[model samples]
Target: MIEIQGNIKTVGLTCGYRNMPIVSDLDIVLPHGKVSCILGKSGCGKSTLLRTLLLLERPLAGDIRFGNLSLNKLTAEQLKQLRRQTGVLFQGSALFNSMTLLENAAFPLIERAGLPRGLASELALLKLDVVGLSRYAHYLPSAVSGGMRKRCGIARALALDPPYLFLDEPSAGLDPLTSAEIDDLVLEICDALATTVVVVTHELRSIERIADHLVMLADGGVAAAGPPDQVRRSDIPAVNAFFSPQSNAAPLIDPHHGLASLLLDEE
Candidate 1:
């Protein structure tokens, strides 16, 4: 198993597209060997922050440091070395349609780790099993359901056994049962592999199921950061509204019934 010993610290971090920052002066520390979920309402820069941590985008300012290595200071070769120790599961799953599940999962090991095809295949199969998709190893992406494709994507991410894993909205577009299954899979992976996982999600159910540490963002800042239980009781307007949205909800209406009918009923 890989040994991930230190926290990922972002000091005064600002992220956005081009010059106009969406989130600014953010200071958050992702604890070591834990599942840290970045939570917020939609379009609040959670995904953007994840991208910055993955070095897919440059930070407008500040530094992203993992243990002793500063991301901003790394040379191209150094950055590549750093990235090999990290894994990312994109929102779309991003599986190649041309390849079988096993082949797609093994591609990372073969390309990045320089493992022989046989060994890579073995490792990939093991990861597939971890995500409960080993039975469908030879199936094409098009043949699988969305959840199965997500499992395959996760298997590929784990192919190289990276200690640090980042998953962007893994539960999005999935049914509640399938989404819960994915949540359980993440917890299982973290326990079995001692992996440090950072999940960017707005799903309350997911955060409740898997998050050990929580960071809720609003107005380009950390509105609340703490354990799940504490964040639930947070008094901050943005944080509170996010967690207990139904508290101030409007009267229920049947969308299938026309709005005019609802108004007539009210009248």
Candidate 2:
């Protein structure tokens, strides 16, 4: 239900602590209720784009709007309100080792939603159930496997029931099967909650499985964008190279063993 009209225009968006420009002239429309994957090679400004969109990094010269509200025009309080409507999952599952799974999941609800501790705990358990991690509620983050930790992170992200969900490299450290599971969970979340999802990823298998739309970033701009099928069919060299199998040079690994191997396995 979020209609992003005109364009999410960025004339000269930049990043880094010194405010240097990592990318520029980035224009994109994230369309409502769709899962958009921002794809790019390493250090091609994909993460910079996501950070700018999330307002974690400032844009050098650009205007961002969500619905009718101009992001730049919003006051600090208003910006906080806007952020409540969105949830973000960082690259590494970013859970606190000191907290149990339930406490980690409930943190946002208690802090942002201002719910009572009892209520927050109840809601967190429910979200954990949704992510199929209810049994791990009492376990510390350090006690779980990598995949479980990611799922815990997902549960925490969903705790607030935000309309927009942003995930950075959801499958970065996992095996193929685990990655596919995360993709399926994302798809299910979108289907069940009708949440608009923006994911930053370099994995083609993930893009093929979960992308409702694709945005390819290169040379400080969007090289191409559309539905996955349309993007694959694009004549643009950058777009074609991105989707082309020949461009994938990463070592194949067994999903179970998490070890590099010579076998070419399909998820």
| TM-scores, each model vs. reference | 0.90, 0.86
Task: Give one digit per residue, the lDDT tens place, for model 2 in 73-109.
Answer: 8787778776887888888888988999999999999
Q: Candidate 2 — which residues are off by over 4 angstroms?
A: 1-17, 245-267
Q: On a 0 to 100 scale, what is the lDDT of residue 258 in model 2?
A: 40
* Candidate 1 TM-score versus the reference: 0.90
Best by TM-score: 1
Worst window of 10 by summed lDDT in candidate 2: 1-10
TM-score of 2: 0.86
Each prediction's RMSD over C-alphas, in Å, is 5.1, 8.2
Model 1 clashing residue pairs (backbone): none
Q: Write the per-residue lDDT of candidate 1 for residues 124-207, one digit (tens) a residue.
A: 999899888999999999999999999899888888778788999999999999999999989988898888899999999999
C-alpha lDDT values of all predictions = 0.89, 0.83
